[model samples]
Target chain A: MLKKPRNGNSAQHKYPHVGRTVSLASLSAHLGLSKASISRVLNGAPAARSIPQVTQDRILAAAQALNYRPNLLARSLRRGQSMTVGVLVPELSEGYATLVLAGLEETLSAAGYAMMLVTHHHQEAKLTDLHRIVMERAVDGIVAVDTSLPVIHSTPTVTISCPDPHDGVTNILLDHDRAAELALSHLYALGHRQIAIIKGQPFSSDTDIRWRSIQIAATRLGLSLHPKLVVQMKENLATDEPGFLAAQRLLATGIAFTAIFAFNDVSAIGAIRALQAARRQVPEHVSVVGFDDVTLAAYHRPALTTVRQPLRHMGALAAQSLLHSFTSGGNHEASHSVVVEPLFVLRNSTAQSPALSLQC
Target chain B: MLKKPRNGNSAQHKYPHVGRTVSLASLSAHLGLSKASISRVLNGAPAARSIPQVTQDRILAAAQALNYRPNLLARSLRRGQSMTVGVLVPELSEGYATLVLAGLEETLSAAGYAMMLVTHHHQEAKLTDLHRIVMERAVDGIVAVDTSLPVIHSTPTVTISCPDPHDGVTNILLDHDRAAELALSHLYALGHRQIAIIKGQPFSSDTDIRWRSIQIAATRLGLSLHPKLVVQMKENLATDEPGFLAAQRLLATGIAFTAIFAFNDVSAIGAIRALQAARRQVPEHVSVVGFDDVTLAAYHRPALTTVRQPLRHMGALAAQSLLHSFTSGGNHEASHSVVVEPLFVLRNSTAQSPALSLQC
Candidate 1:
C-alpha cells in the first residue's frame, strides 16, 4: 500500500498566482514530502493507496512544470527484460578485436540490444569466477572471443575457431584452409608457380586445426611445399628483426619464388620490409599478400592487398545465434559451425607475377 | 574397513601383468562397468554404491597406468567458486585492442585468472541486455576495455577516456598532457620554436584536453601557439580519409612548423603520409611525433617516437582490481582510480627543426 500524501491537502492550496509557478522540488520541500514519494506519484509507481485528490492535482501541476522523467534503470527492471547483452571480450584495445567487436556491436545495437562489455584477460586464472558469470544465467548467453583459449567449458559457448563444435556450443570460423587457398591461388594465378608461404607461428595452443588445414591445402595445391618455405615463427608478437631474418634465409635459399604469402598482415608487412632492404621492389621483383585485412593493411606504405574476413558480420551472427537460443527457452541443440569466407582484396601490394628473371 | 583386498590370501597364481597394463577402455570392457562409473572411480568422484574390493583393484590398477584426470568443471562446481572474470570490450579483432589484450592476457594468465571476453560495439542500443547479464552475475567481475561508453553505471566501471576521479570510477589514463609536454619540451630544447599538432577526432570529447595542455605548456615555455596547429577530428573509426584531409589542410596553411604532435599513432602515420606526398622529408624538413605509441609506430619507416601507454598492464590491473574486490567479501568499497603514466619513446620520427631556410 502506498503511504498517504504527507501534510494532507497543503499541495492543493490555490497558487498565490494562477499557473505562475511551483517547482516539484519546491512543492515537495514545502510540504515535507520525500522526493521518492513525489517521484512515485508522478511516474505512477504501482501502489494501491491513492494520494488525496487535491494533492494528486497539485503533484500533477508541479510535475508539468518540472518535466522530470523516471530513471531508466528503475523503469527497465520492471519491464521483464533489459535490452542489454553483456559482451565479454578478452580485450577491446587491440585492432583486430576492435573490428570484430565493432561489427557485432553495430548489428546488436541496431536490433535494440545494448552491449555491456567486460574484459577479463585472466579468464583462465579465475575459471571458477568466470564460470559463475557464464553459467548462472546472468547474460542471456555467452560469446567467448578467446583466440587462444587456455580453457573451454560445458556451458553454452560460441567458439571462433577452425570448425570445432560442441553440444551446447556454436562455432563460427573464417575457413583457414580457404583463406590460405585464396592467397595461394591468387599468387598461382599471377602466372608464378613458385610461391613461398611463411607460417605465422605454432605457439597458439588452439591453432592445431589451422596448421593441419594449411598442411592439407599445400598438398592439394601440387606446389612443392618446401619445409623451408614453411618458416614457422616461434615468437607470438611480430618483430621486424625476425621477419628480416626469415626473408634473408628465404632469399639465400635461391627458391626463385616471385611471391610471398605470409600467414597474416603483420608478417606480410615484415616480409615487405625484408624485400625492400634486399633492394627487391614490391610486385616487380616480388609480390606479397596477407590475411585478416586489418585496418593497418590499408594504411601501410604500399597498402596491403589481402584476404578479407567478415569479422564484424561473424560477431553479429554469434550474438544473434545466442539470443535466439536464449529466447527460445530450451537448448537449440542444432550446434554447428558458421564459416565466413575470405575475399581477395586487390591493392598495390600485389601485381601479375613479374617477368621471371629472363636469364632463366 | 578398506574393503578388504578382493583376493585376500589369494596371491597365488593369478599375478598377471595384464591388469596393470590395461587401458581404461580395456578395463571397462573387461569389468563390464559403465564408462561413467569407471570415470567416477578413476577421477575420485563420490559414487553412491561402495565399490567391491575386486572392482576397486581393477579401477585403481587401470588408473595408475593411464593417468586419467577428473573433469575440471565438475570439480570446480563442487568447490562452489570459479576463478574467472568477464571482460567486455568494443572488439578484440583490431590491432590496438589485440596488442593491449595480449599484454593483459600474459599478465593475467601468469597470475591465474582466465579472461572470458565479449564484444559489443553498439553504444546506445544493447545496454538493457547488458544490465541483465551483469545482474544475473555471469562472471565474478568485469573489465570494460576500449569501449566508448555512452553512459556509465555506478557499477564497478573502469573507463578508457579521461575519467574524473570525482565520479568514483577507476580510470587508467596515459598522461596525454604530460606526454605532450615531454614532446614539445624535447623539440624546444632542439632549438625549434614553430610547431604544429595533428589532433585526433575525439582527441578530446567535450574539450581537447591534450590541446589545452599543450597550449598551457607552450605558453609557459614562452613559445607562441598557433591556432592552425590545433586540428580537430570527430569520428568513430580511423578511416584515414579525415586524417589525410586534415594534413592536407595543415600543409596548405603554409605556416612552416618544425614539429607536429599527432594525437595517436594512426594520425601520426597519416601526418607522415601527407608530409611525404608534399615532398617534405621526415625529420629533415619536419620532425614528427605521435601519441599512443602503437605497434606500427615501431615498424613505421621512420620509427615513430611517441608516448607509450601501459595498455596491457592497465588491463591486467583492471582484472586484478575486480578479483581483489570480489574475494575481499565486499569490504574494499573504496572505488579508486588507477592512473598509468605514459613514457616518451624516442625514435627516428623526430629531429631538430631543420635549419630555417633563411629567405636571403
Candidate 2:
C-alpha cells in the first residue's frame, strides 16, 4: 500500500481550471484586439505572420496570464482535422501486435497524432462495429494491423501485415519467401531431414503465406514435408497453449523427427517444453527453429534460434505511410506494397541434427 | 505480396462523401421543420421524446437516406464531453504493460470510450508534456500504469501499479505481502535454505514493496537471505538479459545455493539459462521460482513455478473504477486502494532441495 505521494511536482498547478472559464472573446476584449487577429495569433495560422509583432506579443502575453488553454475540440472543428489516427488490431498481446503498436505510437506521437486504439478480437461483427465507431469519431486516418480491412473508405488507410489489399490502402508486409528461406536453409544446413512443423492459427493473416513459403523453400531444397509431421494450431490464443497441444499431437503420431519449425517464438518455446517433457533434449536429439524473434526469443532458455521480423519497424512504417498520405493530400490511389526482409538468428535451440552427427 | 482486396462487401458505400455536403439546415428545410427540432431529433436528445414517434422515425429515415454523419468534434464541443480516456504507460512491451492495456481497451471500448495512448519512456519532461497534451485534448479520465503520476488535477484518475498516491486518484495494486508469503512458503516447504534472489530494477514501481514483502516473509520463515547471494537488476529492459546477468553475478560469488527466486518470469527464465550454462540442471541441482506467471511461463522449458498477478484483471479494475467516478459525478475524493490477490502456480521448475535429499 502507498502511504504518500512520491512525486509532488508543482508544475501542474500552473494551468488550472481557469482556462475552462476564459474565452477567446474575453481575451480579445481585455486586449482591445479583434477576435480574428487573436484567434490567428493563438492558432499560429499562416495568416498570423502578417499581424504586427507588438500586437501578437501583447495578445499572447494576456492569453498566457489568463491561462487560456484552447479547447482541442473547438480547434479541431475549425481546422477540420481531429489530428487522431485509429489503430485496429486483432487483440493486444505481448508478441506481434504489441511490438508494432509500440512503433506506431512513437512515430505518430512525434507527428502530434494521438492513436485511438480498438481491438476487434478477431470477430467479423466486432471488426465492422469498430470500423464504424472509429469512422464516426472522425479519425484522420486508420492503421489496420493483421486484420483484413473491410473496404475502401474516404479516409486514408495503411495496413501492417494485413493480407487483404484494399483499393486505396497501403500495405506493409514481411517477405515470407525470404523468411522461409532463412529459417529453412539454416535447418537444412544443420542436416535436419525429418522435421516437424507447427502452423499458426487459421485466423492469422500470415499463416497461409508463411506455410506456403515454407513448402516452396522445402521443395527447392529437395526436402519433402510429411503430412503426419505437420500440425496446425486450432485455437486463437494469446498464450503458447495451442502450440503445446500441437506439439503433443505431433509426438502422439509416433513418428521420429530430428527438429521442429514452430510458427512463432512463443510456439517454439512451447514445442521445446513438450520435447523436454517427452525426454527429448533440444539441440542434442532435436533442433527447433522459431519465427518472429520477439523480445523473449533471445532470453528463452536455450535461446531460440529463429527468424526475426522487425515488428516495431513494420508498425512505424504503417504510421509513417498513413501520415505521409495525409500530408500528400490523401493520394490514396497510389496504393502500393512495401516489403521488409527477415533476418535469421542462430542461437542455442538449434544445432547439427543428432542423426547427422551419428552418421558422420 | 497482396494482389487484391479480400472483402468486397458494399456496406461502406452507404456512407460516402455525401455526408460532408449535407447539413442540418438542409435537412431542416427538406422536412419543413426548424433546425433546432431537427437537431434535437437527430441527436436523440431527451427533449425529442416529446415529439411523436412517427416524426422521429421520419427524421431518422431522412437522415439515413441523406447519409448524414455528425461531425464528432462539433458534437463534443457542444456536449463538453469528449468520451475519451488517456492511458499513460512507461513503454509498450509484451509483458506487464501490454496485458494491462489489453484489459483496459476491452472494458473502455465496451463502454464506448476511446483510448488516447501515450508512452512517457520514463522521462520527467515527456511525462509533463503528455499530461498537458491529454488535458488539452479534454480526455474524460486518465489511467497511469506503472508510472509515478504528477500532482492531481480536477480530472478523474486511476493508476495501475503506480507507487505514488495523489489526492483524487485511485491506486490498483497487487497484494505483495500475500504474494511473498505464497512464494517463500512454497520454497521453504521444499527444504530450500540457501536461495539466491533477483531484485527488480529500481525504476519499477513495485520493486521496493515487493522486495520489502519478500524480506518480511523470509524473516517470518526463519530463512536468511545472504548478501552475496542476492543481485539486483540494473537495467529497465523488456528482455531477460538483466536477469541473466544478475544470475551470473550470483554464480560468480561462489556461494552454494540450491534455488533462486527471480524478480519476474522473464528473469526466472534467464536465471535458469545461466544455471544451465554453469552445468546446474534445474530441480536436479538447482530450482528456480519466478513471479508474474506471464503467458510464456507455463510453456517455459522448466514451466516456471511463478506468482500470478492477474494483470488483465488489474487493468480492468482501473478502467471500471475511473468510469465509475465519472458516472458517480466525479467523487474522486473517495480515492482508495484496491488490492488484488496473487496466485501461487506450482510447476516443474521447483523441487525439494538436493542437499536435503543428500542428508536423508
Candidate 3:
C-alpha cells in the first residue's frame, strides 16, 4: 500500500501490543549486540562497563533512531528478571515481518529469553489501543515493524522497514536514498539517457527518498529531470489507475524517455499489466525497472528486474535487536541502528532503448 | 509441520503471549454464554441468583465447554474481575492466520474485550512447554488453534483446527472427515474409479481423514483400493529421504492411477512440480484434485480443482466463538460445537475417468 499522505501521531501510527511480558535479558539478546554493553547502556547505572566508545555510540544511536517509545515497565521487571521479550508486528504473515520475527525468536530463545508475540489487525493502530499492551508491563521489551510505534514509558523498543529516526528506540531500516542512487547509476551505466520514474507511493519515506535521489542522480549524469515523464502512484488505488494515468498522459503528450523506473514491484506489475493492456510489448517497446523483488516478481510473464531489499536479513535482524534489548538486564543505554544495503537484481523487465514515434 | 502423534499436555509445545494477564473483563467473555450467568456459575453464587435451570445449564455448558478458568489474582484485585483473555495459536502470520485473526480481532474489539495473543512455533506437537502460558490467574479464559492443549483447571477456553475433542474446550471445527467424503464422492460419481489419494505431512488431520474416507467411500462404491494408490507426501523433509518425496514415490512405482486427489493445494503444488519434472500432463495422463482451495489453487497451470474449506467464514466463526466466550461474562454453562460445511470447487485438475481406463 502507498504511504498515507497524512501523518498521524507516531504512537497512533505505530500501535503497541498489550498482551506480552518482556524482560531485559530477553530484549538485550534480541538486540544482537554484546550483552555487557547492552546492560551498561540500559542500566545507566555506570558500573565498570568496558565496551569501546564507538560501539557504545552505535548502540545508543540505534536505540535512539527507532520510531518507538521506550518500555519503562521492562526496566523494573528486568531488575527482577523474567527472561522474556515481546514482539509486535504489522502483519506477521508478511514475508518481511515473519522473517524478522523468526530471527528475533531464534536469537532470544537461544539466549534463554522466550518471546511473547502480539499481532494486531489494521484497526488497532489507534494510539491508546496500541499503547494499552506495553503500559501494563506485558513484555520486557518490544520489536515493532511497519505498524505504528507505542507510547512507552519504560519498555525499550525497536522499529524497522522505514528510515524514520527515534530517540530511545533502535531502528533497523533500508537506505532508500542510496538504493535509488544505485538504480539510477545502474541505468546510466547501461547507456540509458532519458529515463522516467514511476514513483511508488506518494508520501512513503522510501518512495520520497528514491524520487529525490533519482532526480538528483539524473541531473548529475547530465540527464533532464523531466516532470512529464514522472508518474506518481496513489496507495491502495487500483494498480491500473496509476499505470493508466501515467501511460495515457505519457502517450497523449509524447515524452522522450526511453526507460521507466517504478517505485516497487507491485507498481511495476501494474505497469506491465497496463502496458500489455495497451498492446505495448515489454522491453521490446519500453524497458522498465522496479524496486522490492517480491516473491512473484520472477513469475511474471517477462520477469521483473528489481531492487532487492534484504528482507530475510532485515527480518532476522529485527528479532536479534529486540532480543538484545531484553537480555541486558533491561537496560537500554546503547542506541544503535542496522541499515542494510539493497541489491540490483537483473531480470527481463529492463533492456536497451527501443525506437518509438514521438508525435509531440 | 507434523502433528505429534501424542495425547494431551505432556508434549513439548511452547505457546507464547498467553497465561500472563492481571485484568478482569477479558476473562468473562471466553465463556460465550453470559456475564451474569458466568459470575453465578463461577462464584457459586446460585443462592442469590434467580435465573432458570436452562440459563444455568447454558452458563455451565459454556464454561465447561470453553474450559473457562478465572484468574484468581485479577478477581481478588477487582472484586471478581479479570479483564484479560489469553489466545494461543499454533502460529500467526500465515495466510490462514491472517484471515482468522481479522475475524477474531474484529469480534473481540466490538465486545470490548482486551486480548493477549500467544503464537508459538513448535518443532512438533508435544506441548510440554505449555506451562509457561498456563498455570496462572493471569488470564480468566483461553482460546487456542492448531496448538497442543494444557491439562489443568478448566477456564473458559476453546481450541480450533484440530481433530481431538480438545479435552474440555469448545472444539469448533471444519469436518475434514466430511470434506474428504464430499471430494472423493464427487470424483467417484464423475466415473473415476482408479483414483490415487495424494496425502500431505504424513498423518495430518485432513490427510488422515481423506486417506480413510477414500478407502471407505471406494468400498461403498464397490471400487477396489490398491496399496500403491494411497501415496503420502513429505516434499521438503529434512531427512535426505527422497526430498519432494511423495511425488517421486507416485511416479517411481509406474503404477498408473487415472485420477489423483491431493491432500491440500501445497502438496498439489509439489505434485504439479513433480508432474512437470516427470513430463506427465496433468488431467491427461492423470486427472488431479486437491483439498484446501488456497489462493494459488485457482492459478495453477491446469488450475487445480479442490475442496474449499470456507476459510474466511471459518476464520470469522472461530474469532466470533472466542469473542462470544469473552463477552457473555464467563458463564461456565453449556458447551456449543459448530461444524461448518466444505464446498467442492470444480476446475481443470479433475475430469471423467478416461474411457480407455474405464473399460479396463
Task: Name the best candidate (by TM-score).
Answer: 2
DockQ, cand. 3? 0.06
TM-score per candidate: 0.66, 0.87, 0.66
Give one digit per residue, the lDDT tens place, for model 3 in A1-360: 001123353543353432222333444555677656665775564662666677667666655554122332233233433344555654433234554654564566556555544555333454345445433434456666655453544556777754455676778878776777777777776666777778755434455667777877777777875777887776444233575566555555576666778877656766776676767777777677877775446545477888888876776787676666654644556556788898989998777666433322
How well is each residue in A108-128 modelled by candidate 1, as lDDT tens digits? 656656554445543455434
State the lDDT at A223 in candidate 1.
62
- Which 10 residues in a row give candidate 1 chain B its minimum summed lDDT? B1-10
- Say which candidate scores most in DockQ: 2
For each candidate, the DockQ is 0.10, 0.36, 0.06
TM-score (chain B) of candidate 1: 0.70
lDDT of 3 at B185: 79
Off by over 4 Å in 2: A1-26, A29-34, A50-57, A192-197, A226-231, A245-260, A269-287, A299-302, A348-360, B1-35, B193-197, B224-231, B248-259, B273-287, B353-360
Please give, for residues B26-61, the per-residue lDDT of candidate 1 as tens digits. Answer: 557766887777877776666825777677778777
Q: Which stretch of 10 consecutive residues in model 2 chain A shows the poorest summed lDDT?
A: A1-10
lDDT of 3 by residue, B1-360 (tens): 011223365433453322323222333565445565567656778552676777667666665665444532223334423444556655544345544554555555455444555455534432444434432324555666655454534456766665555444566677766777777777787777777777655423344555666677677777786788777665433111322457678778888777777767656666766776788777776677777675446534577788887766765576676557656754555655788787889988777677556577
